[model samples]
Target: MTQSPSPTLPGSRAQTLASAESLVSAYEKAGYTRAHPGILQLAEPFLDLSGEDIRARMFLTSGRSGEELCLRPDFTIPVSRDYLTSEVAGRPHGYCYLGPVFRDRGALPGEFLQAGIESFGRSDKAAADAETLALGLEATAHFGMDTPDIRMGDVGLFVAMVRALDLAPAWKQRLIKDFSRKASLAQDLDRLSLATANGRPDYQGVLAALTGSDPKAAHALITDLLSIAGISAVGGRSIGEIADRFLEQSALDASATLPPYTRSLIERFFSISSDPLEASATMRSLAHDAGIVLTPTLDLFDARNAEIARRGIDLKRITFSSSFGRGMDYYTGFVFELRDGTGEEPLVAGGRYDDLLTRLGAPEPIPAVGFSVWIERLAGGAS
Candidate 1:
């Protein structure tokens, strides 16, 4: 059976009800049908779909039949699954979900209410992105918070810049993977700038300890060695995957590094932190200085910003940062977080996940964006 939101979920019953009503009604007015995904959901999908951060925090369990399961950590993944299973998934549709999402948040409650809308199949993606973000802001305003800090980012734009730099695909993948962590991202860039001549000890062993033209034989030999050494794959990763990772890392050359100019350009790109309009200009300037074409990404950012302004969300209060994406890998573009002046955690946060549906079983890619408001955080600020 699925876990449902209770009156005692968070805050006062009345306050929770009011916030739920406000969010659901707001999204419904924008043509989103209500969607409720089961709380006890399959675990494998999340294990495969979510980024490392969320994957680490999931509450995992197993059923009587030995099937892995997890308490729902967020509504987006579940609702997307619901939509994909529906007849109308091929067409554009909007969905609103308000319920308890479980997670191990350390000091915070494990069970809390999250309310949000998901827009799918919209042909005008930039408008859809703006509309969802604006809706989150409007819902927050409905709860009486005004002038919240709105931090925006575009993961796609950063990836685009990397692509323009003519970096290797391996390098591009590293940047995207570390985009959500600023300190780690800087370390990643710094590592790229450092040259390494030959393999390290571990790499040397993986390359030299077992040698064969056939990968299957090499994999068997590695697994046998691991078994003898009593080393096992942890955190749901399989032995085969571990072996593959070992091989990939072993094959990498440590001495190869990026050029000084390219590293400087990367730093400049990430240094952009300003109001939405001006940050867009700064990105353009950086691209020009590097002689890398970034107009397409910047144009989309402009269109989305225009849409946000058209909704009267006050672009002045909205800042855009180049390295501000959340830890969720599915966020392909336009990530934002809304918070009161003094709150440690965001009251509302979300972004566009354009490739997510395809990654999560849709026949083709769909344009999607949405945000969720934390009931406790929102109500706590009000109190």
Candidate 2:
């Protein structure tokens, strides 16, 4: 028997092209210079510089020189890297791109088009945030999306809250790192609760193995012990990989956990959520209740929300979820996602990644914000 052909995607090829063109045009009219950095980017930066979210999904390949490479995952990083190395390194500029990106999408297509705008070196925080937010909404509307679910989050605010808390150093580091995943937060806190109640009985053992340690001797000892126990890399994973996992779990077992009160403070912070317009009051109330003083970061969030309103965006369309966080670690400030009720994922997603330029080898920090419009999701989000 012959297999059936795959069904056509939503919106015709022409409609998709038209929507993409409209998106690029909207960005260009808003001051972006059309830029196509092309496909085939170096894979190391995606591994070292980009967030872990995209690291595993990248379609990696090897070059003639045996250097690791990958098909462009997104225009944002390549475009930013280009900008950093160009003559316009530190100056203000807006870049727009529309191109195909490759990745492991599971059931979805591996190759799909993405159109985006990256505004770099903008000194005005509020303006840049507002512009990126507005541009995303406007582009969605331009594609006929009505009333997109404009959900917003602030990694900066989350970091500020973590910093404001009086927690054990280990707990703080763990919380900050795991904050991006909402589900993991609860699990980590639970582990902290149990671990704190019972001190790590193996702490001394870990200290002995990891400290004053010659790494080579440690490796030899570990291999010998594993070999003696008939333990080896199984399930298709390498022995090195198994050893690494063992070491990581051992470290976790050895880590000191937070006191109950510090864990309470973290749980309380995560519980805070409300409408975008009243986010300031909501956070302020949480602060007062917890007796923790949120820094000027809260004020910045409020100001950015106000500036977003000034850009004429309807606040009713936006919701602030304290638990929401983009998986991308480079987002140093405002983070948001715009979704259509019709789709499983956000149609337009972006945030301020101020430190990306520096990671790309730029001499100085470049304040940047941008959003990518998923061509495949525009019509779905619109409906």
Candidate 3:
């Protein structure tokens, strides 16, 4: 027999019905349909997309037959699984889900309501990102909450910049994964420089250690140190290897810590006020000045900004902050979070995860992005 629900389970403020109604209604207005009670999905798929951080925070179990399972942590995976297995293919499918998602433990994580939308088979990536972001904003507005402070970032753009510098593949991957944590990233770069200088056995190992930062001085130091070490007939790490690491690390750090003019240019892109039209120009000008001439990544940013402008959304109300990273590995492009401006944690966050669908083994790649409003956070904010 299945375990019975506790009396308190039915009384969670996080499961409040009115909020559910409001969330579902906003999703409906955005063309998503109520997606039913939902199916339980394997935890590994969601963990794979969410990366190690979420994996560590999960509640997991095994069945009587010894099959591994996990309490459903979020709605996006199960919904995507349904779309992939059902007749929803060959046509666009927009779905909204509201139900209990289980996480291990937090302030209020035994069970919580999650409301979100996922559109599969969508071709217009930019429009899709904009529409999804708008839905979250509208939902916050519906709650009569203060206007949300919205900022956006591009993970793809960041990775593109890393790749363009011609850094080693091993080093590039490390930086991309650790870009969100500034201090950790810097330390990683420092260690990589030191290892390169010390004639470490594996260049790749040194590269991995250096993943957190892109600093020119560190790179130069590594090169000079390695050249001196190499002259003494040291270990496996070569003089060329040391110099390469130095130059790569230096260039990477230098780019991240751009000069004043370039920094100002990048800063202007982050200044997207409520006017989407003005924000689009800001992004275009900044990208142009970044000498991102050959990179379609910047072009994509401009296109998405233009789409937001075309939608007649007030960009001034939504700040186009360039540094606004969502800090998840799966977000490929157009990430944003909605905060209540009281200096509290973000109430909602969402972004495009085009690579995630393919990573999750969908029948075909689906360009999808959506946001989850932290129900507990919203409730606390309201109270």
Error of 2 at 304 (Å): 0.3
lDDT of each: 0.80, 0.78, 0.64
**Model 2, range 1-383, lDDT digits (tens) per residue?**
11112346544765776667766877788789888786988988888766666887999999999999899888888899888877887999989888778878787788877888899998898888998998888877888876788888888777877777766554566667777767777888788778789766655586536644565676667777778888777786666666655554555556657678777776666676677767778888877887777858888888898898898887777888877788776787788999877566888999999988888888788899998878867754222
Compared with the true structure, the alpha-carbon lDDT of candidate 1 equals 0.80
Q: Name the runs in model 1 displaced over 4 angstroms.
A: 1-11, 196-231, 234-237, 251-255, 381-383
Candidate 2: which stretches are off by over 4 Å? 1-11, 168-170, 208-255, 380-383
For candidate 1, what is the TM-score?
0.89
Model 2: which ten-residue window has the lowest total lDDT?
1-10
Q: Model 1 over residues 109-140: C-alpha lDDT tens digits? A: 77877888888898897788888887888867
Index of the highest-lDDT prediction: 1
Candidate 3 C-alpha lDDT tens digits along 1-383: 11223446556553455666666777777678677633455666766677555676678877777766787776767776676677875367788776677766667547765677777777888778878777887767766675777767777766665565444565566667776665665665665565445543435455545555555555656767766664623355556565665556644443232234533443354454444456456655655666664257766766777677677666666665444566567777788888878755677788877777777676567777777777666666331
Q: Highest TM-score: give the candidate number.
A: 1
- Candidate 1 clash pair list: 196-254, 196-255
